[model samples]
Target: MADLSLEQADIIGRVALERARAGNSQPLTVVVLDAGGHVKLARREDGSGIARFDIAHGKAWGALGMGISSRGLAARAAKMGTFFTALAAVTEGRMVPVPGGVLIRDGGNRIIGAVGISGDTSDVDEACAVAGIEAAGLAADIEER
Candidate 1:
């Protein structure tokens, strides 16, 4: 399994922030989590909400844990509301089914980590994450329905 490097995590965070700025998004919080669901890096822009970190972490962690983009999770949640609610309870609120969490894949298509961004609309946050992952020469997996 390929591991997520510190350099890659840094690049993802930096580029995501730049994308957010270029898109005129409200302040953002970005979190990168290794495949094992450990946080590799986290950043919060000025004016980001106080819960931004937690929200970002939850998004990444949820994606990592479920082996799918949070967008997919959101879709699943919509169809299985009771199950998703149980998931959130079991995770103690760590799971956030939303569009901003994306899986990071290596050249071989192996998932190495995940990136989560919170701030603007979920779609905008997801776009920034995809940009950052691509900038780092990695693939961003967003399981679109």
Candidate 2:
């Protein structure tokens, strides 16, 4: 069983909001998912663009589905463009090979779910996402899965 819970999701969202505020940028959208890729929680900060939420969700979903961080996916996509592109189509465009998503892991490095943030550059978004996961006391790899 996974250790992920709604409380952790809330913590992640709060941390993301804090990071976004610290950066003095637009509001961010945060999403958290369970091991099975089900949404555990999602928050759309006020003034965030509507599209931001979808991007955040896609990142989180992709992380959970791949059992790895979205950053890893992006790297692989760069090496295998055609295959990754086809995967996006097969996933109905839900699988996004972009940064801003990090897979949550337990103390033993067991995958739990993922957290994703949007409303900034891909790098900034990914940093915020990783920050939130760290704030929630979850283990996550910033560069690799």
Candidate 3:
């Protein structure tokens, strides 16, 4: 699968930050992952915590690995918290079921990977993530958002 370009990732970060600004969210952290759930790009704006990167990456990775939005995973987890906890353990603590991450689909609606954003409320984070995906001319599905 063709990987998301760094240029595209940069644009995604920029768009997300701009959207967050419009929404009154503080500094943000944005991460993009490839189809294999590998980091393609990560950006943390000034004042964003270093831990934000881990949160963003975890959300993106979880979405890609489960082939669903993090919000959907969170919903499923809400019904089985222990299972979701075990999943995090199985992933070596890299997976997180949250509302801030979304799968990225190409023009054909094929899953290409995901984008994650953190440093705000889950709803705001999701908004930034969705904005990034849409700005990249891709589709984002957050069934449980």
Highest lDDT scorer: 1
Q: TM-score for all predictions?
A: 0.97, 0.92, 0.94
Quote the lDDT for 75 in model 1. 91
Write down the lDDT that model 1 would get. 0.93
Q: RMSD of candidate 2 to the true fold? A: 1.5
Model 2 clashing residue pairs (backbone): none
Colliding pairs, model 1: none
Models, CA RMSD each: 1.0, 1.5, 1.6
Q: Which ten contiguous residues of candidate 2 have the minimum total lDDT?
A: 136-145
Per-residue alpha-carbon lDDT of candidate 1 for residues 30-85, written as tens digits (9 for 90 to 100): 99999889989999999999999998898888998799999999999999999999
lDDT values of the candidates? 0.93, 0.84, 0.87
* TM-score of predicted structure 3: 0.94
Query: Cα deviation of 26 in candidate 3 (Å)?
Result: 1.6
Residues 39-141 of candidate 3: C-alpha lDDT, one tens digit per residue? 8888888999989999999899999888989999989998998898899889999887989989988877788879998899888999998898889888888
- For candidate 3, give the lDDT: 0.87
Task: Judge candidate 1 at residue 13 and give its lDDT.
Answer: 96
lDDT of 2 at 87: 88
Candidate 2 residue 122 Cα shift, in angstroms, is: 1.1
Candidate 3, pairs of clashing residues: none
